[model samples]
Target chain A: MMRSDDLVMLYSGPDQVDYAYLSPETAGVYQNKHGSFQHRSLVGKAFGTRIRASNSDGWVDALAPTPELWASAVRHRTQIVHQLDAAVVCFELGVRRSSVCAEAGTGSGAMTGALSRSCGSVHTYEFNEARATAAQGEFERNGLTNVTVRHCDVCEEGFRDLDVDSVDAVFLDLPEPWRALPHALRVAKPGARIATYSPCVEQVHRTRDALSTCLDLRTLEVRQRDFVVKDVLLETGLAPPAKRRKDYQNEDDAPRRYANCAFLAWF
Target chain B: MVDAGDEVVLWTSQGTYLFAEAKVGSTFRWTKRERVRVDALIGAPFGATFEIRGGALVRAAPRGAATTVEDDGERRDNRWLADDNRAQRLDADDLKRMRRDGASGEAIIDALVAGSDTFAHKTQFAQQKWLRRKQNKYLPWVRVLEPRAATIAAAYFSRGNLLPHRVVLRPDTVAQLVARANARDGAKIITVDHSGGVALAAILERIEPSGKALVPHRGPFEALRRCNLTDLDRRVVCFSLDETPPPQGDSLVLVAKTDPIANLDALLPLLCPSAPIVVYSDTVEPLAAAYAHLQASGLATAILLSETWLRDFQVLPNRTHPTMSMSATGGYLLSATKIVVADAA
Candidate 1:
């Protein structure tokens, strides 16, 4: 494991200037990754040409994706998971700050960031070399010494390196969560919570079917739900709306301010 | 005070102050002889009116004197009219005062209207002002607000699941609900949270249909936010509790888990024992659902939706047409223990 002080070298600071390297050729593959990874931010100017100091204030991630694991995923530019899902997983999945967790398909390292925040350590797997390198750099940048981002793909590589039957939680946000289900079932402690973030219904259905063979899969879908908090006028005749409309147009037209629903499923 | 042919301020139960011109006539006629009735009036200029009743000073009007009325049928017709006049006078005074105080007329109007005592008045004034401002500030002398269906829909969808959180009603809808609640003679108005309770207070501000004002019961909104609230989940927990909690009678509950004004909910519950309610909070997971959910849990119920649901949620173009989402709204008439999902949509 890299030292915590070594992780601070990714930022552009006085000491880590030599290590603050940006390879454009490496950035080629990740140019188009979209799940909230390509948005422009006003806070990106701090990413200078050197390793800078690291701080973990809530505001660090307020504007930009400051969660080190998420940033590692972003650095690789793979299809990263969203923050909401990560927060839900960390807070609701009963994953404590001391638990050991395993995450498959470290595509963008989002789950890795989330797992690192709660558990004592996280063993995450990713296949792409360039993505792994970027993620490693991000991990070092954010001073995350707990997460071990492996270069091998979980399907073929498996969890041979880690202890058997040890992890507390398994979070799968991959394309084929079922492919990793056997690996998860084999290693996931009994009654351990497994959360998967799949967009399409087919993915959810397939994952559920696979998990049911051994696990008491409780299928749950989480959508981004918004609460409209407007001032209630008593004297004037304003109360709850006469109806509750459940459907929404698309995210682009509305821009997610008025309402947001995150369709999610848990196993 | 009962002198015949006296010029007096005939302060009625309503908050209207009519400059009654006095004459030797019947009660109705003589009541108009410069006779000021402090009934049905929204804002009367301080010491503005002098009344003549039966040729004597029957009653006197004081400056900045606030009065209450019994909201009976006699002074009803003039309520709206008197309110309008009072508003107009306020408007006129506001305009002059602004000029005297070296402020812009528009600024004065904005301040006064913004400070309006009621949401209805504020909305009405703002709608006009905003429209005029848009016309003046923008080009083409025209501003067309596209039907914000997409935005409303997005907002609705953003709430993830509506199972356990509190929904804020626009002011007008609350008023209408309060009026309906007032009309209910023996029943209590149940709400989801302290905000709703405040809404109830606003509703019962004038004409509490019930003999006294409708007290509010408070609940939690924090639960709504933190907990993944679902309809089935709400039913499972609230009904399964061994202790049959006290029934909420005719009260409003404004549900906010982290509201600084939790005391508001506390005050209302103490004032009206039966009016306790639950608010769906993002932080506090109150053990109640929307009013409809409560009704389904087998408690006799009346569910009030905020009127602005249409505009705020983008269900209808305006507050006129029936659009989507009303299935959970309107007061529900149901037996306690029988949960029925009414067609609010």
Candidate 2:
């Protein structure tokens, strides 16, 4: 049974999947299209089980929270790394169970959560104290004990809190990854992989140059293209034989395009 | 493995090539004028360069590294040049012989510049373009890459072969789909992969051992076979499209190149409420219909998003702009969280 402070994905309707923290002490009722249900009612229930409201016909499914769900449901104070870039960074870094990883400039802790899920431990450094504290609380609330959120500027001080040459991988999401290269190198074990994410080529070039001496550098950008699938209905028109009715003639169903650009440098 | 008969990619300055290694004495012709012994590359490291018969050297290009183009600080205003002034001092035969004699790409480019009577008079941009053109022609470097999903997908997409299969999923798209689905350790995921199992392989890579995948397909699992994922096969339960999946709670449902509505309808009941259902298609009509169906039925909620991908290249210092050419359509994604509706009072 789920207990107090357990993070759950509360599903009330097709459009309302909320990431909620279960608290027995405070009276927090989750209201949705169906009805309202108190957090207290959800505490003793098993995950994925439906809970009903006392006053009305409202019900919500308290589902277990996964990293992806948390990422989508979490509050975003900064531009967060979406799943695509995070996965690539993890893969490029060769993050595995038992691998100790390091991250700098933890923007929203989205990647921090992802790393925490995959690796043995993550030492994430965020320059902004407030964000770091907030992330630390979020991690704790989510029961992510594997992650340690530090309110420190890694660019100036480096990952000095960790042992030198102890880290197995490093992920840099900083504006100036080149600045942290020395510290990353110091913390990284021999042949340990490193990955840096940047949107601009100038930053990539700088990072590439900085890593050239010590690491075998390779750079790439991950681009995902999404297509909408529809069944076309052909129809005939009265005007001309050539203008016969076309199948699936929804004018608004035209294919649309969206692109996310994140430059990844791995060595 | 860098075996004698394996197909490898040779990334040169101009473009990438798929080279099949033959016996030791066999010569691999790079071009009509350029050829190298297969033995030269048989045992070499993937990204290392080797000298050929002549002075020409070819390096196996590193994976994901863009072709290097250094911008020299040479300033010139845009000006139209007369065709008559574009005279070359070195003839075609001499240039070909220089390449045959083992001159490097840079050396050949320098010779071309020195041989051009009007080279100095051209604008910096024009000079750079000229150098690029020459370098592409003379550079013999080729980086061999292992045939992973990303490299193979890129090569196939570049060759326009990804269309017939209706699997235009890029590396980024695969990564996004896997992550968004939250396919991790012990997570149960249902995948309908049409991209030659590349998507499935990516999912398996993320969620292994403890995680289970229900893959329903119509034909032989050639894609999965090619990925060398036999080790993870035990964790995967394969079935035909007509077969019913065993009753189990799946945390994620990933649909590609299939009917999203029908698949979701069949699979939604087996998913844990609040499970994410990610649908990918080349077009949007079906997904839009599925979104409407989900909303109308109150089966899912949160943001029902349809995102299209656009990639732009930042060329750095001076030439910072979007690339002139890119794939117009990467694809579209429809992501939503599933919800279970209880009977009203």
Candidate 3:
């Protein structure tokens, strides 16, 4: 049975999936393309079971939330890091189980969730108060106890709350990552890995310059290309004339492909 | 050469000396006419110019050139060399005597310039080119480099034959693969390496001794053996392909060599949900097939990537571009996270 306050993915179809935190007290109705449902009634139901909406003939499945699901369903209060880039960042930072990691500008808590899942503890700082509070709420609702969200500007004040040279890895996803590099160096232990993500080359250059003295730096841009599968009818020479014509006309159609580029620096 | 016992390439006017040792007091029979002593190079930094016994001077050639000239935003004018027609006045015997007299490379170059009848009429670009050509030939130098994976790969690739045993994995690509695999301390990793253990070396470097690496091989790993990783050997266990132990859950698996798809399938049941699996191949076709298979299985989120590294020579402050020659392709990497999908409704 699904528990109260659990984040669930309400799946109607590929195009109309919704994520909602189950609540027992609030008499709220959640509506989607399928139908409307009382949020209170979703509790105590088994996940992956279809439930009929009270107002319409449509039905929806309440699915459990995975990291990938949460990534796609999370609220985009800020520009969220793509899942591919997040995975690469987590890997480059060497975020392992029981490892201590620090992150700056926890926008949308996208990568924060990944870090919390992979590491022992994550110290994430967000400059905006509202985003930090919202991320904190999300973390609590998702039962992510290993993460600590702080509403402080890490660049101006540095990571003073944490002990010096204590973290195992540091990840920066800020506008001015170069400005926060000194603090990252201060918090990270000797031989600890640091990774920074920026959208432009100029930012990477600045960040690289800032870290050149203390760390062995390597910069790369990771690109992810996704391919989808689709069935194509073979046009055999012995095929029927009409079927052969149809197959020839459909040759131009292909599945959609997605590619995204992310610039990264690690040491 | 800067370090003792390091392998270096000593370039001279006749030809290049391959695999020369950088030992103090060692004498190199540079050419039939010249003999060079290593004592003059022991303490000198790589790329430093020194005068030898002969009138010829040699500069230590670093693996890569250092930035010295600043870009003054001047464009090359090809038409400026149209009217330049001059002949050289300095003979070979004079240069050889000058080298035997222990004249500096700069002094020899100055003499060569003084002897060139057309040196005054040549354009600045042509003059610089001529000076550089002379410096490369007459100013003999040795570039000393530490033997890492990159240098080893480069040496093998430049042999004019692409052998499968020689892993052409670049240093950057190795770093990317390790990172993509999420290798870490205490993690159990399974690898199938045939590129003389280059991949294994990289994995061992990242995971250290805390993690255990299982390499399935029919024979000894020559590349890894050359690395002298005796202390870390305890962490690496070798097994036959058909009789390897089953992997525990939540372990990283890296497949670099033959039959990646088969290896991945055999290891699939052992991986925990969301465990990262990285497969590398020299070509994309195999990885593309692997990607399709993984996608069809409905248990993976596979992403395909190909990394091409471009090194740039920052010649001048304002004139920076990619080096003239570069490796066209390093390799293709396919990274996927294993997932347990619920039964379809």
Please give, for residues B1-345, the per-residue lDDT of candidate 3 as tens digits. Answer: 256654444433322323345676566665686566665555554334444445233443332232133345565554555443446677889888997788887799889889876766655555655776776665655443333333333333444255555545654456556656756556677777766666676566446547777766533455455343556557687655465465463444554557768878877776665466778777777777888788688666434444434342222223333446656666777776665543332
Native-referenced DockQ of model 1:
0.01
Which has the better DockQ: candidate 1, or candidate 2? Answer: 2
For candidate 1, the iRMS in Å is: 28.3
DockQ (model 3, Cα): 0.10
The CAPRI classification for model 3 reads as: incorrect
In candidate 1, what are the lDDT values of residues A156-209, reduced to their tens digit? 657657766788788876778778778877787754667776766567666766
Q: In angstroms, how far off is A101's CA in candidate 1? A: 0.5
lDDT of 2 by residue, A42-140 (tens): 776666566778778666677778776666667888888876677677755656565899999888998898988778889999999899999998888
Q: Superpose all Cα atoms of candidate 3 onto the true structure and report the RMSD in Å to 1 decimal.
A: 8.5
Where does candidate 1 stray beyond 4 Å? Answer: A1-76, A225-265, B1-258, B261-345
Q: Is candidate 2 or candidate 3 better by TM-score?
A: 2
Q: Cα miss at B169, model 2 (Å)?
A: 1.1
TM-score, second chain, candidate 3: 0.68
Best-fitting candidate, measured by TM-score?
A: 2
DockQ of each: 0.01, 0.25, 0.10
Return the interface RMSD of the candidates, in order shown, one decimal each: 28.3, 5.3, 7.7
